[model samples]
Target chain A: MIAAIRVFGYSLFAIFIGLLFMGIGRKIIARIQLRLGPPFYQAFLDVGKLFARKSITHNFVMDLGMIMSLAGLLSTMLFVPVAGHMAIKTSSNLILIIYLMAIGHLGMAMAAAASGNPNATIGVSRALTMMLGYEIPFFTVMLGLIIFNGTSSLELIAQSQAGGILNWNMVKFPLGFLAAEIALQAIMGEKPFDAMVAPAEIASGPMVELGGKYLGLAFLTHAVSIFVETGIMVNLFMGGASNVFTFVLKQFEIYLITILIEAVFPRFRIEQAVKFLWTVPMSIAVVQLAIILL
Target chain B: MMDSPSYMLSKIAEKDNLTVYELFFGPNHPGMHGNFGYVLEMIGTEIVKVRPNAGHLHRGFEKLMEQKLWVQNIALVPRICVADPDPNEVAYCTAIEKILRVDIPDRAKFLRTITLEMSRLSSFLMGMGALAAAVGLYTAMNIMTADRDLILDLFEWLTGARVYHMFSIPGGVRNDLADGFVERLYKVLDHLEKRLIEYDKLLFENPIIHKRLKGLGYVSKEDAVKYGLTGPNLRASGNPYDVRVDDPYAAYPYLDVRVITQEGGDALTRAIQIRLEFEETINLIRRALKTMPEGEIRLNLGNLSALKVPKGEAYAKVESSKGEFGYYVVSDGGMKPYRVAVRGPSLPAGLLLAQKHLPKMKIDDVAAWMASLAICPPDIDK
Candidate 1:
C-alpha cells in the first residue's frame, strides 16, 4: 500500500508538471512576440472549460475513437513504472505500450479523417508523416534499451538506470538519451515536430474537426500521454526523481527544453523530417553504441 | 489565350486517356486565406496546371470608392492589401492631393512616413508568420501574429481603429501622436528585437525549415520581372528596384535609406529578403521619430467644394510592403475625379504567379509559392 502511494504520487506530479508546461508554452510564445499572453492557468482553465462544455455527438465512430484514445493513454500510463515499480506491470507490456501508443495516435488521426473536413483530411496526412518519422527513432531507441538490459520489462529498464543520477542510463549510454531526446520531443508533439497540429496550416490538425466533449477527450488523452511518456523517460533515464519533488523538477526540465526548441525553430516538412530522424540521429545512436562497447 | 483548368484538364483525355480531375484549392483549403481558390488539374500531388479563381472577397472597391465621398474612400482602399494598408491610403490621397494641388505640411510628410513604416513592420511580421505557417512552423507563426496584435493595438490607439484606419486625409493626417506614444513605440521596438531571437531559434536555424522552404518555390529573375513581381519578391530575385528609392516620395528623400535584395527569387529568398528589410523598416521608423519637425498637420484646403486641377493625368507609385502600388488620376475640373484608377501591387502577381509560375510544383508547395508571391486577391478583384 505504501508502494501504491508512491506510484500515485509520481503520476499526479507528472500530470501537474505537464499541464504547467502546456500553459507556459502558450504564454511564452505570446510574450516573445511583444504581447501580454494568456494567464498561467490558461491551460488548466482550457481543460476545465473542456469538461464543463456541452457534449455534442457527431457520429458513434467519434466516440469509439475518443474512447480508444483514452484507453490507449491509460494503458500506456499503467505500463510506465513509477519509482521503478508500476501500479500494474507485466513483462510483455512493453509490446503492449508500443501498440497502445501508436493506436492512440492512429485513433485520433482516423477520427480527424472521418470528420470529412478538408483541413482535417490534410491534418491526418501530416499526422501520418509525423507518426512515420517519429516512431522509427522511438522504436530504435527502445530496441537499444531492450538489448542493453537483456529484457523488455519497463521495470527492469528503470532499475538498470538507477545508481544515482550520474550513473543513470542517460549518462552511461548518452547516445540512447540523445537519440531518444530528439524522438521524445517529437513524441511529446512539441513545436518543430508539431506540424501535425499546426493551427494556421490546417486549422488545428487531427482534432480540428472534433468538438464539444469529443475534443475535450482528445485534450485529456494528450495530457495523460505527456504524463505517461515523461514518467517513462524519467524511469528509464533520470531514475524516478528520488522523491515527488525531484520527479516534478525533472519533468519540468524536459518541458522547458521542449519550449526552448519551440521558441527557436520552424518545423520541417515530412520528407525532410524523415531524413533527419532516420539518418542523423540513428548515426548518433550508432556512435553512442560504439562508445559504450569501446 | 490562356486555357481554363478544364482545357488543360481536357488534354489529359487525349494523352493516355487519363481521367480529367477538377480540384479546388481554397476558400477553405489549408493554404488559402481570406477566401481564395485555385481550379487545377492535379495528377496525384503534382499540379499539372492551375487556373486562378478569385472574387470571394471582391468588395468592389472601384464601385465603392465612387459612392463614398473622397474623404471616406480613404477607408476603402487599405483593405486592398490587408497586410500593408498605409500605401493604399497614401496612394489614393496623394492622387487626390495631386488633383487638388494640396501642398501637405512637412510634419504630415513625416507622419505619413511613420504610419507607412509601422504598417510595413506589422505587415512584414504577418507575411513572415504566414510563410512560416505555410511550411508548418506553427509556434513561430503564432508568435509572430500574437506579437503583430500589439502593433495593431498601437495603430488602434493612434487612429481609433483596429483596421480600416481612414486616418489619412487628402491634404494631411487626422491626428498627431498622443503623449508618450513615441516612447511606447521604442519599447515595442526593443521587445521586437528580443523576440526575433526566439523566432530565430524556432525557425531560422532549424534544418527542417530550410529544406522545406529553400529552393522549393524557385522563380527565376526573368519570370519575376516579366510577371511584374515587386517588393520583397522582386528584390529576392536580385532586383534592387524600389519605388521608395526610384520615385522618392513623402519623407523618403529626407531620410537616407537602403534597399534590401537577395540572389535567389525563391520563396525562401523572398522570406529572407522580408526578414532583412524588417530591420530597415524599424530603422526608418526610428529616424522619422528623431528627425520629425514641429509643424502644422494639413495643407490649406480653404475650399472643399470647387476643387479643380489641370486636365491631365498624373500617376504616382509607392513602394508598398507587398509591392509597388500606384494611382492614376485624371481630373476634369470637378469636385470628384474624372477617372481614378488605383493599381494594387499584389493584383498582377496573384494572376500571373499562380496561373503561370505555379506549374510543375507539387500541390503541397502551392501555398508556400503563392505566399511567396504575396498575392492579395482582393487587391486584384477590387
Candidate 2:
C-alpha cells in the first residue's frame, strides 16, 4: 500500500513540476526578447479554468482516450525513479515504460481520430509521423544505456552512474546526450517541431475537435508528458534529484532549452520533420553509438 | 476548377473496403485565405485528385463603380482589397484625373508613394503571417503579427486609423506627414531592419520551414503567364513585370527600385520575394521622405461639383501590393460615372488561377498556395 502511495506521489509531483514550468517557461522566453510576459501562476490558472468547464466528449472514443492515457501514465511512472528511487523499479518495468509512452500516444490519437474532424485526423497523422521520426534516435539512445548498464532496470541504471553528481550519462557520452537532447525536444512536441498542432494550417490540429472536459484531460496528459520525459532525461543523463534545488535546477534547464529553441525556430511540415529526424539527428545519434562501440 | 491529372499518385489500396471520397476544401477552411478552397480526393495517405474552388468573395467593384458619383466612388474603391487599399484609391483617382485633365502637385505624388510603400509593407507582413500559419508554424505567425503591429502603429500615426486607412483622396492626400514623423519613420525602418535578422533565424533560416515551403507550390514561368498570375506570384516565376515600372505612376518613375524575383514560382519563392520587397519598401519610404516637394496634400473635389469630364473615356493602372490593379472610367458629363470597370488583379490570380494551380497540390498545401497568391476577400467579393 505504501508502494502505491509512493508511486502516486512521485508521479503527481513530476507532473506538478512540469505544470509549473509551462507558465514560467513562456515568461522567460518572452523576456529574452526584451518584453514582459504573464505571471508564474498563469499555468495553474489556465489549467484550472479548463477543468472548471463541464467535460464534453465528442464521442465514446474520447472517454476511452482519457482513461487509457491516465492508466498508461501511472504505469510509466512505476518505472521512473524520483529522488533516486522508484516506487516499483523492476527490471522489465523500464521497458514497459517505453511501451506505455507509445501506447498513451496511440490512445490520444485514437480519440482524436474518432472525433470525426478532418483537422483532428490531420493532427493525429502529423503526430504519428513525428513519433515514427523521433522514436528511432530515442531507441538508439536507450540501447546505448542498456548496453552500458547491462540492465533494463532504470534504478540500476541510475545507481551505476551514482557519484558526487559528476558521474552521469551526460558526462560519459556527451554526444549521445546532445543527440538525445535535440531528439527529446522533438519528442516533447516543442516549437519548431510542433507540426501536429499547427494552428494556422489545421486550427491547432487534433485538439480542434476536442472540447469541454475531454480537452481538460488532454491538456493534463500533455502537461504530465513534459515531466515524464524530462524526469527520464534527468535520471539517465543528469544526476537524479541530488537535492531539491538540484532537481528544480535541472528541470528548469530542460524547460529553458525547449523555450529558447521554440522562440528562435520555425516549424517543419510532416515530410520535412520525417526527413530531418531520419537524416540529421539520426546521423548524430549513430555517431554517438560509434563512439561507444570504439 | 478543371480536372487534375491525378497521374503522380500510385494506388496503394485495393477497391474493396477502402472507398475513395472527394472532400471539398471550401471557401471556409482556415487555410483558404479568405474565401478559397479545393476539392480533394484522397485514398488514405496519397492525394489522388484535387480541384481549387474560388469566387466566394465576388462583390463586383467594377460594376458598382458605375452607379456611384465620382467622389462617392473614392470612398468605395479602397474597400476592394483589405490588405492593400492605397493603390485602388490611386488607380481610380488617376483615371478620374485623366478624364478631368488635372495635373497632380509634386507633393501629392511623394505623399502618395509614402502611403503606397507603407501599404505594401503591411500587406507583405500579413502574407508572411498567413503563409507561416499554413505551413504549420504558429510561432512564425505570432512573431509576424507582433512585428506587423508596429507597422500598423506607424500607419495609425500617419492616417489615424489602422485596418481601413481610406487616407488616399482624389487629386492629393488627406494630410501631410506630421511633425518629426519622417524621423520617427526612419527609426521604425531601423527597427525593421534589425527584426528581419531575428525573423530570419525564426522562420527563414530554420531548415524545417525551408523543407515545407521551398518547392511545394511549384509553378513554371510559362504557366504563370498563361494563367494570369501577377505581383510576386508573377515575379516568382521569373517575370519582372511591375506596374510601378511597366506603367510608372505616383513617384515610382523618379524612385530607383530593382524588381525582386525568384525563378521558382513556389511558396518559398513567394515568401522570399516578400522579404526582398520589404527591404525595398523601407528604401522607397526613405526616398519619398527625403524628396517630398513642399506643397498641399489635398486637392479640392469642389473643382468638379457637376463632375463633368471632356466626355472622353480614360483608363489608369497602379501596382498594388497584391498585383496590378486597373480602373477604366467613362464619363458622360454627369456627377456620376457612365461606367467605371475596376479590374482587380486578385480575381485572375486567385479565382481563375487558383482553379488552375490548386489541382497540382495536396489538400494540406491548399492554404499555403492560396496565401502565396495573396487574394484579399473584399477584392474578390467586389
Candidate 3:
C-alpha cells in the first residue's frame, strides 16, 4: 500500500514537471519570435479544458491505443531514477526502458492507423521511419556507456559518475554525448527532425484525428514522455542530481537546448532526416565506441 | 462508360495489389494559402496523381467588374489578389488611362511607383513567411508577419484602410503624400533593413532549409519560358524578363530599376531571387521618394462617376510581386466598361505549372512548392 502511494505521487510529480517545462518552452519560443507567449501554466489549462470537452473515437483500438500509449510512458517513468529515487525498487534497466518507450510509439501508430485518415497513416509511417533512424545512433551511444561502465543499469551508471562534474559521463565521453544529443533532438520531436508532426505537410500527423479527452490524454502522454526522456538523459550524462529540484533543473537545461534548436530550424524531409541520422550521429557514436574499446 | 483515366489507373493498381488512396490537401488544410484544395491520389507518401480543385474562392471578379461603373471597379479589382492588391488597381487604372489617352502627371507616376514597391515588399514578406511555415519553421513566419504588420500600419496611416486600398485611380492616387509620411516610411525601411540580416541568419542560412528546398522543384530556363512563368519564378531561372524593366510601366523608366536575376533554376534560387528583389524594391522606393517632382496628384476628370472613355481597347501591364498583372479593357464610350479581363499572375504557376510539377513529388513538398512559386489561389480562380 505504501509502495503504491509512492508510485502515484512520483507519477504526478513527473507529469507536473513535464507540463511546466512544456509551458516554459513555449514562452521561450514566443520570445525568440518577438511575440509575447502564453503563461507558464498554459499547458495545465489546455489539458484541463481538453479533458472537460467531448471527444469522438473511431473504434475500441483507438481508445486502447491512447490509453496504452500513456500507460507505457508512465510505466517507463517508474524505471527512470529521479534524484536517485525509483518508484519501483528495481535496477533501472536501460534496455528495458528503451524497449518500453517503443511501445508508447507503437500505440500511437496503431491509433493513428485505426483512424483511417491517409494523412494520419503517412504521419505514422514517417514517425516509425524516424524511430528507426534515431534508435540506431541512440543504441550505439548507450552500448558505448554500457560497455565502458560494465552494466546496462541506468542507476548504477549514475552512481558511478557521482563524484563531481568532471567525473560525469558527459565530460568523459563528449562524442557520445554529442551523438546522444542529436538523437535526443529526434527523440523529443524537435525541428530539423520533426517531419512526422509536420503541421503544414500532414495536418499535424498522428494528432489529426485526436480531439477533446483523447487529445488531453495524448498531451499527458507527451508530458510524461518529456519527463522520461530527459530523466534518462540526465541520469546518463549529467550525473543524476542529489535531489528532485536539481534533477528537474538539469532536465530543463536539456529541454532548453532542444527548444532553442526547434525555434530556429525548419524540418527535414523524412528520408533526408533518416539519412542524416544514419550518417552523422551514427558515425559519431561509432567513433565514441571505438575510443572506449581502445 | 467506365473508361475514365482514374478508374483505369485504379484497376491497374489493384492488379498489382497497390493501395492507392485519395487525400484532400486544402480548403481546410493549414498549409493551403487560401480557400484552395488539391485532390491528391497517393501510394504510400508519394503523390501519384493530383487534381487541382479550384473555384473555392471564386467571387466572379471579372464578371463583377462589368456590373460596376469604371471608377467603382477600382474597389473590385483589389479583391482579386489580396496579398498584393496594388498591382491589380495600378494595372486596371493604367489600362483605363491608356484608353482615355491621358498621361498621368510625373508626380503621380512616382507615387504609383512608391505604392507599387510597398505592395511588393508586403507580398514578399507573406510569401517568404508562407514558404518558411510550409517547411515547419514557425519562428521565421512569426517574425516575417510581425514585420509585415509594420508595413500594414504604414498603409493604414496613408490610406484609411489597411487592406483593399482603392488608393490608385485612373488619373492618380486618391491622396497625395501625407504630412511626414516619407520620414515614417524611411524609418520603417531602416528597421526592416536591420531585420533582414536576422532573417538571413534564422532562415536563409539554415542548413536544414537548404536541404529541404534545394533542387526540390527544378524549372529550367526553357521550361520557365514555355510554361508562361512570370515574376520572380521566371527571374530565378536566369531569365531577365522583368515587366518593369522591359516594358517600363508607371515611373519605372524614370527610376534606376535594375533587373535582378538568379542562374540556378530551383526553389532555393527562387527564394533567393525574392530576397534579392526585396532589397532592390526598397532601393527603388527610396529613389522614387527622393526624385518625386511636386505637381498635381490627379488629372481632375470632372465628376468621375459620370466619366466615360472613348470606343477603344487597351491592355496595360504592371510587375506585381507574383508576376506580370495585366488588365485588358474595352470601353464602348459608356459610363461602364464593355469588357474588362484581368490577366492575373498566379494562373501560369498555380494552374499550369502545378500540373507539371506536383506529380511524383512527395506530399510534404506540395505546400513548400506552392509557397516558393507564390501561387495565389484567388488569382488562379479569378
Candidate 4:
C-alpha cells in the first residue's frame, strides 16, 4: 500500500513539474518575441478546461491507444529515480527505460492510425521515421556511457557521477552530451525538427482529430514524456540531485535549453531532418564512442 | 452487375498499387492566407495533383464598383487587398485623373508617395511574418505583427481609419500630414531600422531557414516574365521591371528611385529581395519627405457627389507591395463609371504558377511556397 501511494505521488509530481515547465517555456518564448505571455500556471488551466469539455472518439482502438500512451509514459516515469527516490525500487535499467519509452510513441501511432484521418496517419509515419532518425545517435551515446561505466543501470550511472559537477558525464564526455542534446531536441518534438507536428503543413498533424478530453489526455501524455525524457537526461549527463527540488531544477535547465532552441528555429522537412540527424549528431556520437573505446 | 463500380475501381487501384487520397488544403487551414483552398491529391505525403479552389472570398468587387458613384468607389477599392490597400485607392484615383486629364497638386503627390511606401512597409512586414509562420517560427510572426501595429497606428493618425483608409479620391488625398507627423515617422523608421538587426539574428541569419527556403521554388528569368510575375518576385528573378522606376508615378519621377534586382529566381532570393526593398522603401520615404514642396492638396472638382466625367477610357497602374495593381476605368459622361476593371497582381501566380509548381511537391512545402510568392487570395478572387 505504501509503495502504491509512493507511485501515485511520483506520477503526480512528474505531471506537475512537466506542466510547469511547459507554461514557463511559453512565457519565455513570448518574452523573446517582445510580448507579455500567459501565467506560469496556464498549462494547468488549459488541461483543466480541456478535461471539462466533451470528447469525440472514433473507435475503441483509439480509446485504448490513448490510455496506453499515457500509461506507458507513466510507467517509464516510475523507473526514473527522483533525487535518489525510486517509486518501485527496481534496478531502473537504462535499456528497459528506453524500450518502455518507445511503447508510448507506438501507442500514439496506433491511436492516430485508428482515428482514420489522413493527416494523423501522415503525422504518425513522420513520427516513426523521426524515431529512426534520432535513436541511432541517442543509443550510441548511451552505449559509450554504458561501456565506460560497465553498467546498464541508470541509478548506477548517476551514482558514479555524484562526487562533484566536474565528475558529471556532461563535463567528461562533452561530445556525447552535445549529440544527446540534439537528439533530445528531436525527442521532445521541438524545431527545427518538428516536422511531425508541422501545424501549417498538415493541420497540426496527429492532433487534428483529437479534441476535448482526448486532447487533455494528450497533454498529460506529453507532460509525462517531457518529465521522463528530461529525467533520463539529468541522470545520464548531470549528476542526479540529492533532493527532489534540485532534481527538478536540473530537469528545468535541460528543458530550458530545448525551449531556447525551439524559439528561434523553423521546422525542417522530414527528409531534411533525418539527413541532418544522421550526419551531424551521428558523427559526433561516433567520435565520442571512439574516444570511449580508445 | 458482376461487380460494383467502387469494387471494380478498388480492384484496379490495388492491381496498380496506387493509394491516392484527396486533401483540402485551405479555406480553413492555418497555412492558408485567406478564404482560399486547394484540393490536392496526395500519394504518401507528396502531391500527385492539385486543383486550385477559388471563389471562396469572391464579393464581386468589380461588379460592386459599377453601382457606386465615382468618388464613393474609393471606399470600396481598398477592400480588394487588405494588406496593401493604398495601392488600390491610388490606382483607382490615377485612372480617374488620367481620364479627366487633371494632375494632382505637388503636396498631394508627395503625401500619396509617403502613404504608398508606408503601405508597402506594412504589407512587407506581413508577408515576411506569414512566411516565417509557415515554416513554424511564431516568434518572427509575433515580432513582425508588433512592428506592423506601429505602422497601423501611424495610418490611423493620418487617415482616421486603421485598415481600409478611404483617403485618396479622384483628385488627391483627403487629408494633409497631421501635427508633428514627420518627426513621429522618423522615430518609427529609426526604431524599425534598429529592429532589423534583431530580425537578422532571429530569422534571416538562421541557417535552418536558409536550408528550408533556398531552392524550394525556382522560377527562371524567362518563366517569370512569361507568367506575368511583377514587383519583387519579378525583380528577384533578374528583371528590373519596377513600375516605380520604369513607369514613374506619384513622386517617383521627381525622387531618385533606384531599382534593385537579384540574379537567382528562387524563394530565398525573393525573400532577400523583399528585405533589401524594405530598406530601400524607408530611404525612399525619407527622400520624399525631404524634397516635398508645400502647395495645394487637390484639384477642386466642384461638388464631388454630383461630379461627372466626359466619355473617355484610361488605364493607370501602380507598384504595389505584391506587384503591379492596374485600374482600367471607362466613363460615359455620367455620375457612375461605365466600367471599372481591376488587374490584380496575384491572379497569375495563384492560379497559373501554382499549377506548374505544386505537383510532386511535398505537403510541408506548400505553405512556405505560397508565403514565398506572397499570394494574397482576395486580389485573386476579386
Candidate 5:
C-alpha cells in the first residue's frame, strides 16, 4: 500500500510539472511571435476541458489503447531519475528505459489504427519511420556514454559526472552530445522532423480522431514524454542535478532551445527527414563512438 | 454471404491484389485552404488518383450580377475573389466602361492602381502566411497575418471598409484618398520592408524550408503555358507574360510596372517570385501615389439604380493576386445585364492542374503544393 502511494504520488507530480512546462512553452512561443499568449496555466484548463467533455470510442481496442498509451509513458517515467531521485528505486538501465518508452508510441499507433483514421495511420507510420531514423544515432551516442563510463545504468552515469561543469559528458564527448541534441529534437517532434504531426498535411496526424478524454490522455502522454526525454538528456550530458528544482530548470533550458528552432524552421518530408537524420547526426554519432572505443 | 456486413467489410479491405484506400482531403479539413474537398485514391502513402471537389462556397456571383444593375454589380463582383477583391471590381467596371465608352479620369485610374496594388500586397501576405502554415511554421504565419492587418488598416482608413470595399464603381472609384492616406501608406510600406527581410531570414533562406519546397512541385514552362497558368505561377516557369504588361489596363498604361520572372517552375521558385513581386508592388504603389493627378473621382452616371448600358459585349481582364481575372459583360440597352461571365483564374489551376499533378505525389506534399500554388477555391467556384 505504501509503495502504491509513493508511485501514485510520483506519477501525479510528473504529470503536474509536465503540464506546467507545456503551458510555459506555449507562452514563450507566443511571445516570440509578438502576441499575447494564453495564461501560463492554460494547459491545465485545456486538459480539464478535455476530460470534462464526453469522449467517443470506435471500439474496445480504442479504449484499451488510450489507457495503454498513458500507462506505458507512466511506466517509462517511473524508471527515469528526476534530479537523482527514482520513484521505484531500481536499476535505472538506459537501454531498458529506451525500450519501455517505445511502448507509448506503439500504444498510440494501436489506438490510432483501431480508430480507423487514415490520417492517424499515416501519422503513426511516419512517427515509426522517424523513430527508426532518430533512434539509431541516439542509441549510438548513448552507447558511447555507456562505454566511456563502463556502465549502462543512467543513475550511475549521471552520478559519475555530478562533481563539476567540466566533468559533464557534454564537455568530454562533445560530438556525441551534439548528435544527441539533434536526435532529441526529432524525438520531441519539433518543427523540422515533425511531419508525423503535420497539422496542415495530415490533419494533425495521429491526433486526428482523438477527441475529448482521449485527447486529454494524449496530452498527458506528450507531457510525460517531454519529461522522460529531457530527463534522460539532462542525466546523460548536463550532469543530473542534486535537486528537483535545478533539474527541471535544465529541462526547461533544453526545451526552450528546441522551441526556438521550431519557431523558425519548416517541416521536412518524411523521406527528407530520414535522409537528414541518417547523414548528418548519424555520421557524428559514429565518429563519437569510434573515439570512445579507441 | 454476399449481402452480409462482414463480407462488405472484407470487400473494402481488399481489392484486386492491392489495397486501395479512399481519403477525403477536405470540404472541411485543416489541410485545405477553403471549403474544398479532394477524393484521393491511395495505396499506402502514395496517392494514385485525385478528384478535385469544389463548389461548397459557390455564391453564384455571375448569375446574381445579371439581376443587378451595372453600377450596383460593383458590390457583387468583389465577392468573387475574397483574397484580392479589388481586381474583380476593376475587371467588372472596366468591362462596363468598354461598353459605355466612358474614359475614367486620370486621377481615378491612379487611385484604382493604388487600391489594386494594396490588394495584391495583402493577398500575397496571406499566400505567404498560408504557405508557412502548411509547412508547420506557425510563427511566420502569425507574423505575416499581423503585418497584413496593417495594410487592412490603411484600407479601412481610405475606403471605410477593410475587406469588400465597393470603392471602384462603373466610371471610377467611389471616393478619393482620405486625408494623409499617402503618408500612412508609406508608413505601412516601410514596416513591410523590414518585415519582408525578417521573413526572408526566417523562412525563405532557411535550408530546411529550401529542402521542403525546392523542386517538389515542378511545372515546366511549356506545361505552365499549356495548362493555362498565369501571373507568378507562369512567370516562375520563365514566361514573362503578365496581363499588367501584356495588356495594360487602368494606370498600368501610364505607369511602368516591371514584370518579374524566374527560371525555375517549381514550388520554391514560385514562392520566391511572389516575394519579388511584393517588392515590385510596393514600388508601383509609391510611383502611382507620386504621379497621381487631382481630378473628379467618379464620372457621375445619373441614377445608379436605373442606369442603362448600350447594346454591346465587352471583356476586361485584370492581373489579380492569383492570375488574370477576366470579366465578360453583355448588355442589351437594359438596366440589368443580358449576360455576365467571370473567367476566374483558379478554375483551370485548381481543377485541371491539380488533377494532373496530385497523382504520384507523396501525400505530405498536397497541402504545401496547394498553398504554394495559391489556389483560391472561391475564385474557382465563382
Candidate 6:
C-alpha cells in the first residue's frame, strides 16, 4: 500500500514537471516571435479543459488503447530514477527502459489505427518508420556508453559521472553526444523531423480523431514521455544532478534547445528525414562506438 | 472480430477496378486557405483525380452589383476579394469612370497607386505565410502575420477601416491621405524590407523547404500562357506579361512599372518571383510618394442617388496581387448598372489549373501547390 502511494506521487510529480516544460517551451517560442504568450501554467489549463469536455468513441479499442498508452508511459516512468530515488526500486537497466518506452508508442499506434482514418494510419506508419530510423543510432551510442562504464544500470552510469561538469559523459564522449542530440531531435518529433504530425499535410496525422477526454489522455501520455526521455538524457550525460531542483533545471535546458531548433527550421519530407538520420548521425555513432571499443 | 474485419475486407476487395480512396480535402480544414474543398481520388498517397468544389464563399456578387446603384457598388466590390480588396474597388470605379467619361485627378490616381501597392504587399505577406504553414513552419507564419498586421495599422489610420475599406468611389477615392501618412508608410516599408532578409534566412534558404518545393509544381511558359495564368504565376514561367506594364491603368501609365520574371516555372521560382516583386512594389510606393501630383482628390459626380450614367459599356482591368482583375460594366442610362461581370483572376488558377496539375501530385503537396499558386477561393466563387 505504501508503494502504491509512492507510485501515485511519482506519477503526479512527473506529469507536473513535464507540463511545466511544455508551457515554458511555448513562452520561449512566443518571445522569439515578438508576441505575448500564454502563462507558464497554460498547459495545465489546456488539459483541464480537455478533460472537462465530452468525448466520442468509435469503438471499445479507442478507449482501451488510450488507457493502455497512458499506462505504458506511466509504467516506464516508474522504472526511471528521478534525481536519486526510484518509485519502483529495481536496478535501472537501460535496455529495459528502452523496450518499455516502445509499448507507449505501440499503444498509441493501435489507438490511431482503431480510429479508422487514413491520415491517422499514414501518420502511424511514418512515426513507426521514423522510430526505426532514430533507434539504430541511439542504441549504438548507448552501447558505447554501456561498454565504457561496464554497467547497464542507469543509476550506476550516472553515479560514475557525479563529481563535476568536467566528469559528465557530455564532456568525455563529445561525438557520441552530438549523435545523441540528433537522435533526440527525431525522438521528440521536433521540426525538420515532424512529418508524422504535419498539421497542414495530413490534418495533424495520428491525433486527427482524438477529441475531449481521449485527447487529454494523449496529452498526459506525451507529458510523461517527455519526463521519461529527458530524465534518461540527464542521467546519462548531465551527471544525473545531485538533487531534484538541479535535475529539472537540466531537463528544462535540453527542452529549450529542442524548441529553439523547432522555431527556426521547416519540416522535411518523411523519406528525407529518414535518410538524414541514417547517413550523418549513424556514421557519427559508428565512429564514437569504434573509439569506445578501441 | 476476425470474421467481421475479413468480411469488410472482402467487401472492399470485391471492386477490382476501384482501388482509389476518396478524401475530402477541406471545406473546413487547417490546410485549406479558405472555404474551399477538393474531392481527391487518391491511390495510395498519390492523387489520381481532383474535383475542385467551390461556392462556399459565394455571395452572388455579380448579381448583387446589378441591384445596387453605381456609387453603392463600391462597398460591394471590395467584398469580392478579401485578402486584396482594393483591386476590386479600383477596377469597378475605373470601369464606371470610363463610361461616365470623368477623368480622375492626378492626386487621386497616385493615391490609388499607393493603395494598390499596399494591398499587394499585404496579400503577398499572407501568401508567403500560407506557403510556410503548408510546409509546417508555423513560427514563420506567425511572424509574417504579425508583420502584415503592422501594414493593416497603416490602413486603419488612412481609411478608418482595417479590412474592407470602401475608399475608392466611382470618380475617385472617397478621401485624401490622412495626415503624415507618407512618413508612417515609409517607416512600415523600411521595417518590412529589413524583415524580408530574416524571412529569407528562415524559409527561403532552408534545405528542407528547398527539398519540398523546388520542382513540385511545374508550369511551363507555353502551358502558363495556354491556361491564362497571370500575375506572379505567369511571371515565374519567363513571361514578362504584367497588366500594369502592358495595359497600364490609373497611375500605372505615369509610373515606370518594372515587370519581374523568372525562368524556372516551378514552385520555388514562383516564391522567389513574389519576393523580388515585393521589393519592387515597395520602391513603387516610395516613388509615388516622391512624385505625387498635387490636385483635387476627387471628382464631384453630382448627387449620388440622382446620378445617371449614359448608355455605354466599358471594361476596366487592374493588376491585382493575384492576377489581372477586370470589371465589365454596362450602363443603360440608369442609376443601376444594366449588367456587371467580374473576370476574377483566381478562376483559372483554382479551377482550370488545379484540375490539370493535381492529378499526379502526392497528397501532401496539394496544399503547398495551392499556396504557391496563390489561389483565393473567394475570387473563384465570386
Q: Which segments of model 5 are wrong by more than 4 Å?
A: B1-11, B16-18
Complex DockQ, candidate 2 = 0.34
Q: Write the per-residue lDDT of candidate 5 for residues B1-382, one digit (tens) a residue.
A: 4754334534676763547778899987787978988989888988999998877998888888888878788888888888899999999899999999999999999989999999999999999999998888889889998998999998898889999988888888888877888898999998898888999998788787788888878999899989999889999999999999899999999999999999998899999999999999998999998899888888988887778999999999999988999989999999999999999888777899888889999889998899889899988887
Q: A1-294 in candidate 1: lDDT tens per residue?
A: 876775566456545666776787678866764557898778778877878888755456667877887766766777776565556445635667777788778777667655645456566787777777777777777777777778887777776666677868888777888888888878877766776776545556677667777877787777778777777777767766556567756776776676777766666655666677788777777776666556
Candidate 2 docking classification: acceptable
Best by DockQ: 5
Q: Enumerate residue pairs that collide in model 4.
A: none
Instruction: List the TM-score for candidate 5's chain B.
Output: 0.96
How much lDDT does each candidate structure score?
0.74, 0.75, 0.91, 0.92, 0.90, 0.89
Model 5 error, position A116 (Å): 0.6
Tens-digit lDDT track of model 2 for B54-106 = 56766776777778777778778888787888888888888888887887888
Ranking by DockQ: 5, 4, 6, 3, 2, 1
**Could you list the CA RMSD of all candidates, in the order they appear?**
5.6, 4.7, 3.1, 2.6, 1.8, 2.1
For model 5, the local distance difference test gives 0.90
Which stretches in model 3 have alpha-carbon errors above 4 Å? B1-18
**Residues A54-82 of candidate 4: C-alpha lDDT, one tens digit per residue:** 99887788888999999999999989998
Compared with the true structure, model 2 gives a TM-score of 0.90
Query: Candidates' TM-scores?
Result: 0.85, 0.90, 0.97, 0.97, 0.98, 0.97
Error of 5 at B128 (Å): 1.0
Q: Which stretches of candidate 6 lie over 4 Å from their true place?
A: B1-18
Local error of candidate 5 at residue A247 (angstroms): 1.0
Proportion of native contacts found in each model? 0.37, 0.36, 0.81, 0.78, 0.75, 0.62
> B1-382 in candidate 3: lDDT tens per residue?
2654335645666775867777899989989989999988888788888889999998998888778999999889999999999999999999999999999998888888898899999999999999999999999999999999999888898888888888899898888878999999999998888989988988888888888899978999999999989999999999999999889888998888889988998999999899889988888889898999999888988888888988999999999999999999999999999999988888888888887888899999999999999999999888
Chain A TM-score of model 2 versus the true structure? 0.93
lDDT of 2 by residue, A84-202 (tens): 65566466346767878887788878887766666677788889899989989887887788877788777677678778656888888887888888888888898678878876566
lDDT at B344, model 3? 83
